[model samples]
Target: MKKTLAVALALALTATACGSSDEQDDKSEFAENGTFVYAIPADPGELDPANAVLGATNTVLAFAYDTLVYSDADGKIVSGLAEKWEAQADKVTFTLRKGVTCADKSPVTPQTVADSMNYLSDPKNKAALLGVLIPAGMTATADEAAGTVTLATKDPNPFLLESMTAVYVVCGEGLKDRSILKDKTSGTGMYPLFTSVANDHYAFKARADYAWGPGGAKHEAGMPAAVQLKVVKDESTAANMMTTGELNGAQFTGADRKRVEAIPGVRKGSAPDGIGEFFFHQGDGRAAAENKVRGALVRALDLNELRAIASGGDPVPATRLISLAPDPCRGDSVTGNTPPADPGTAATLLDETGWKAGTDGVRTKGGEKLKLRVAYQTSAGPGVQAGMEYIAQKWKALGVETELVGSADAKYADSLFKDGDWDMAWVPLGLSLPTQLVGYLSGPGPDEQGSNFAHIRNPGYEQLTAEAAKKVGASGCEQWTNAEAALVENVDVVPVLRPTQLVASKNAMLEVIGGVVRPTSVRMLKN
Candidate 1:
């Protein structure tokens, strides 16, 4: 009787195993069978963590790399490689996670963390965009025995964690080859790069041992075995790919929004607009220092119109440097203060600066033509180009000669500052936290130790930025408020509207993830 019962139990177990196998296959039909394809609008300019300035490159590279900590959709810092941290009076200690390895199979160590931070903070590293992440005079040290690192700052810097959100740690060995920055990436992220078919075509496979997944990530990730990202420069191409099932996800432009939303299985994700502006080089010893001319340039701009041009007909206009989300300081105050878009004011200011009209009908001051060259990174979108052309026309009506110079991506750093040949240009500044503004405001330039880009040196503004860096919570808020106001009143840049980020995905093949889904988040997805 015992033998007969055992035979029956074995049959039942086999039947149960068969049923489970069928269920797993049914649930994973799309993810298990197919490579998740994505259509990115442009080629990722750089994959190196240190050199990726454009959003497109950062979006893709971030998946293969990660910062120390990142805010989830709810804007709270969850762990990445470092499990948790403690901040004492003089030292900040981060406990490193174990079992995580880089794409090249190198283990993540405290020394690796220290080297990455040190490189980012070094002025010689040409990381001006990342300079804001380090506190002035801060030094990094590693305790290998404890698997911890302590960062000591000369002064009490309030936004250290916020800064770390931008600096992704890399293994010392991987960084020895900086050439990868120009074309590919290698980091210790959940996804590892597998192939680079071309400039815009790449693929990655999930690392089975990815230990630092964010809190509450879908267990198992049901992670796709393979992922593909395709470069499609035109918005229409990306939008079409979403409909035809060629792309599981993409970022949409104004032209693609209506059509993309019309698709049955797609949803949209949005991010705060990046700041855009027409920069005037004040260090050139030219007319940039003339207050009336600066005021006139400010008065002639219609921000509402400029916003429309910059967003490719998306009409959201920004009034201040700070975004209008959460507890932004008096962002509403700017709504009523923007200067009128009147050419008469521009002409009057030019007259006051002694730039009277000459026989050629162009403004002339001290034998120099009122004409100035306006340069922009050729990589800037159609909207940015349109905005520049509009401003050139308005300035021309006021007897100003404006010549537009377009530059390639490689020439951006040199053209903007090093060549020092430009009079004005449209440059975008990306500052994650309020304190990072110091690089543009007070840091030494290439020739000098500090960069006064706009040649804007207000002792008051510098002091306020410094004070903001020292305090936390309410005290920090107060200092930032003062610094923000000083910038607006001084007319630092033309103060064009900020830009937004848009990501679209197909709903049928996969579930849309939630929260502040950046392009980096999109790249890391399997389904």
Candidate 2:
């Protein structure tokens, strides 16, 4: 049996289930070949898998790259580039499948895969997936004759194999010159980049000989000969395209969901993306740097109302940070862990902390005013924008001066990692394993080339997670749950709601694994 992790990011807000339509049961035949067109929210910057972070970039990369292993919708590890794999606490070995070739027609060798891993593990390379997928300081070795690549880490990782499912393998050519990947493909996926028009659209040509897909899936009858992704920023516009047959599939998470659900003959389904979390920056001089102020600010907002507003309806209240399916640790660490909604208590806490209300109704501590710059991703849809605005309104009522800053994915990343201008941010750090979150939650800040943007220093969380990492797989679930509870209890971060992402499709039958359209699972229907 193989261990799995739910680490897929929701790409372009859409994914299709195994059974995309009720009519598929009745109809056994479909079109032989056609183009499958879909919509993405923004331009996928830097096609190199190592540097790709934006969900849109991942969506495009999904069609052009393959991982060492494949994680199904059910969170099961299956064969991908590797025919088989063995994972232990400190190391993992992958056996390459025969006849695998890169988009450039070069045969994929074990050394090529090892070089990709080695590149990501090196800090000097500055790959975005450095610690997220390939652990920092990890090393890889390849045996050409045996056709195997083994990855070893000094620190033990129970979920090491699960994390490998997210690393996109780059071929030798792309590794030498990454600029080629910016506008093209250099991987061993079913589709290769054929044409790219930046923010407008991207087209990929299907490889007829490609056979190694998730769980041995292959190109079959009715599979799209080509795939095209159009940049459609507006949900209503994307939904309209889906209805008019301009788009084969699209995802809606906001008010446009109702419109997509009403379109007849469109196959629809839902998946758990991740929790919409509020992370307070603990950097010096920030208002939220004070623990009492953080608690008071959280208490001022009605979480129930905010969840409804953010999700566009009643959503499942997030129980833990891992909202994706098949969560190894099934426990509610968020409930009864956060501060309750009590404006009076919030005001009292602020008053006790020297944040007294002034003549302008804004709280002031010493001589400085209580001000916060709240940030969010504008591309997260209108619900998120409204949710940020709602927080600002609630904070204003609590006499805390607030400024809401919303930007696209690239700009948002720059704000959190480069500029460091935000006091609090409504960012969703989605991951399948608790161990994978250690760097983002505790390690060095962005200034030190680490992802701990919040700069959280919860000693209890670090201690608990360290103990949990020593154990293997599910045995450490209890400590992991307790660690998350400690973070919530300390008001270091707030888990709000887990939104059910809705996807709809027309004239196409396909399956989405790990929030990406499995290239071989797509089957075109006759118009």
The C-alpha lDDT values of all candidates are 0.61, 0.80
Q: Which stretches of candidate 2 lie over 4 Å from their true place?
A: 1-28, 103-105, 172-179, 285-287, 323-330, 354-369, 407-415, 418-420, 446-450
Question: TM-scores for all candidates?
Answer: 0.77, 0.86
TM-score of 1: 0.77
Candidate 1, residues 93-206, lDDT tens digits: the string is: 788887667778887788888887777667677653344456546778999999988887776766676556556677635677666555666687766677776666878877
Instruction: Predict model 1's lDDT versus the native.
Output: 0.61
Worst 10 residues of 2 by lDDT: 1-10
lDDT (tens digit, per residue) of candidate 2 on 88-197: 88898999999998888888999999998998889887777766667768999999999999999998987777777777999958977877876777898899889989
lDDT of candidate 2 at residue 390, scale 0 to 100: 93
